[model samples]
Target: MRQATLDAMDEVKRSLDGIEAARARLASRPSSLGGRGLDGVFTRYLDHGSKQLTWLRGTLGSATALAGVASEVGDSGMELGILQMTGPRLQAAMFGTLLLATWVDFLQLADALLRDCPTCGSEKLFADLHRVQSRMTPTLADLASGDSERIEAAATAMPVLMGELTHEFDTIRREARSAMEVGGKVMVAAQVMELLALISTLNMSLPRPPPAASTTLGMGLVMSSGGVIAGSRLVVSAEWVEMMRRLVQAGVISLPAVSAAVRIHGGQVMMAQANQDLPEGVREALGDSPEVRGMKVTGKAGAGMAEAPRHHVMPKEHREWFERRGFKGDMDIDQFCVRLEQSHHEAIHGGANWKLGRTWPREWNQMIMQLLGKSGRETGRALTRNEILNIVAENMKLYDIPMKFTKGRRR
Candidate 1:
């Protein structure tokens, strides 16, 4: 098994070599936006790729060191406890390394496609890559309207590749979190059992009503021995070692050609699609099937649709409530909504609003987006007062609160 770990170290090194080769290939492309030009996207992708490669190399070194140490420890429980504690951190590092490698690979392919395309020539970027990448529809539309079949194919394939990557990262994140939780619980339980065993031993062997000095010394010894036993148990269990071994093996297999195994679910594909305002041509390229049409851009679902460009607090009841309470400012509306919910809860069951005013509003906004089934990039407009009130009304209505807000404020 140790030999296999040593072999994994070699495999990681080879992967690094492949990454370096890909980086070199990316660098060779003309980056200027002019004739036969290379754009800023290429430069940005290369720079990000370089940083990720550096991180991967550093993490690989750490993994190699850990493997070597484990080999020498050879079944020592105390050493095993140290390794067990270190296991999750090592797994996380490997995960990061592999994930970054995969991202770099995607960037490499994207760079190649853009550089090779005639219609979407490598134009110098005036803005950030994220700004361009986030708004992919315009680029796709350009490709679709032109005679550049190669570029069109690349543009269409990009979203599919992106969907696969999202699924892989999401899956790994969830599985790694679950593994860490289970490993932690196992360690804790082992320690607790060891403590119980020590207490039982003391109870059986110690004199009934022993001397105080002897009792104190014996108690100290019991605690010290219990700690040793607890530490040893983690390494001694075949289950734990096997888990770590499997995690290491998985890391070895995750980087190269993982997209083949990753199933791109509808949510990821829809998110990639909805984040952009796709042109009809590009939509046709993406099959323009019923599944595609079923998806909507942000804030355009069923009865939730708003024709007006803006929405605001039009209801006299809400305006009066706000004025009577003397709550002014944009944040004040958020506070009112939160407090209203808390008041009703307190009225019924009596509990304070733990997440009151100014408590991680950014996080609260993110949570709001998640609940609304929208991503940050897709949310192009800030909700007006009436819009906020409408959302609050949905929750409030669940608790039987009157939703008296007008749909749109009159200009």
Candidate 2:
């Protein structure tokens, strides 16, 4: 088996050489060969096809062998499944490892493609930021429209928004693997489960930009909080999501700012789609988050709390009752809502306004279009509206009472 593995590995090497040669030969050839007037580069994807084929074969063989072992172990009645197998336990472990290993191999290749210029094989980042950006150089001006800018901004911000989650996952990988004993393993296991949820929530949180604006209008709330990586955009990066999962699970960041807790049920956005205008600093503090875009407007679902009463007191009835005497039955929930579900959501949010509010006023919803700007003025991060919202919402709780339904219903 070892020799076979080695032989397969060797074959891959030979194939890689052939691919390089094909590319080199194509370089000397003219544009007829699809070099597109370029040297040492293939004008088309076919140029590197042979090497890819080789890599795939070797990868498949190793992955298959490991996966089989994993399945057998999974069939066993073990306490826990892991890779250090002498028996069934080993099998399950191998399966999990193989999956991650396969993903890693792909990651390396994809990273190379993005980081190294495909045409010149140069390390000088020709495509890493956003693949969309590299393709849009039309050399012709006045041919573009506002739509193009909006599209570019969104596509560019996708990965940048996934920033914190990236670091969280890195920490998880390091710490989770190091926990070997029962207590340590248990801790890591629980954390892994929670982190997994955080990761999923983050993904769902920023899957796409709102339909209204070409730019990220809804994500204003997320960016203003500084969760945004400086040069990136709305697209969530895998690395960033993973990091956030790890951090929250491990208790690194208590009360992690996960995706807003709106559930989609029966074709309806369950929570109020909503907010009211705060001062400029408050707005800035909200960040360019897609979630809180147009904090001065109303909600999509017509259920925002900001449109409720503005008085510092609770619901009129509740307050009157309190002023006169106490209630007869249990009115904690109802009473609290009176304090929270008010005009501008301020009746509830007055003390907690610093947090990225989950709810908004009616009018602010329309102003969402002006949320996050369309550009990343830095060199390393991109600004996605959702990310900005998460940042702002998370930070806001500091000044308030941390009123999340979980985060004080900032759900």
Candidate 3:
């Protein structure tokens, strides 16, 4: 009868081993490419454990009642030796029932550990498992309340049950740690990929480039398009404005990151267009030149602010043009401004004019005069202030540029 009871306990342990393996698979399957929607497996397995435990508990209760009845019949001289014969078996059944409850608690803990993760609510689950472990590994003194024979039976069962529980506890801890370790990195990578995907969508739909114009002619065209032409071209290129609205509605990427990305990309696009229109000679000269010139201008004073010598730039109106599109997130305001100045110079004249001091060059003034004459209705003279202003306004309107006009002669 002892051997038979031991065999039954071994069978129960084997069943538990299978259940543990299934639970581990259930937790990991969602991470696999082919198993994305297989999470239903966990729910189904939990339900199965619940049903089995209910049946097992009822069976154990019935066996206990039968044991009591058999003991009474023996006292009445029925000559039925069931109590004496089934002593070890009855002990085994009671101990096994307790182990089964522990197993169910463990299953519940595992389910909780796997479900709320990356969100990381495993503390409660771990607490419950610790309580079960304490119960399973109780001291021998606790069983001393029964007769010496019952104490011996508990001693025999306790070690086996504790060994099984210990093994399961180790398995859960290791599996949970591994799952969480990989889960965090996977979540971040997935989000970054999504943002990149949206950026690609924007790039794919960019409008075809406008017809190629001469360095001088393109400058006039850009200026004439309106202060906004450069920016407007960017607007239609990607349909990013609409994309941003949708992204904001969806609430995927952080608003700050999105804003920074849009600004950086727009600035880069404008720089590319400016580079394209540059004269080959100027572009070549800049590639070979290493000298950097500093330009300075005074800041307008406010109540508590002192006037400072700010770095000046050529085609002064363009400083504002770059600012409207925004700056790179990684760089400081000064560095961003420096890059803008460099790009603006390369766009207009094909290279940095380090040889020229802070003052606006005569050549730049001549070019502006020429642009005014070309765009104006009249011929033969550098355009007057009113004529230049009117022409710039008309060009900005026609070409959709986003820059504002400055009447200052130095710009």
Which of the numbered candidates is closest to the native, going by highest lDDT? 1
lDDT of 1 by residue, 3-34 (tens): 54455456557757876786676677665353
TM-score of 1: 0.32
Number of the top candidate by TM-score? 1
lDDT of 3 by residue, 1-411 (tens): 222333333444554455545545544544333322224534543454444445444443443443344343312211122222223333333344445444554554455354434433445455545565455544223332222234333533343344445445545544555566577645544443334334332232123233352122222112122221233433122233333333322221112222222322332212222112332222221221221011011111321123322222224544443243331121112221111234343333432464443343433433544565465536654434334334433433333322311112222
lDDT of each: 0.36, 0.29, 0.35
TM-score of each: 0.32, 0.18, 0.24
- Give the clash total for candidate 3: 16
Candidates in order: C-alpha RMSD to true structure: 27.3, 27.1, 37.7
Q: How much is the lDDT of residue 222 in candidate 2?
A: 26
lDDT of candidate model 2 versus the reference: 0.29
**What lDDT is reached at residue 47 by model 3?**
50
Worst 10 residues of 2 by lDDT: 260-269
Clash count for each candidate, listed in order shown: 3, 84, 16
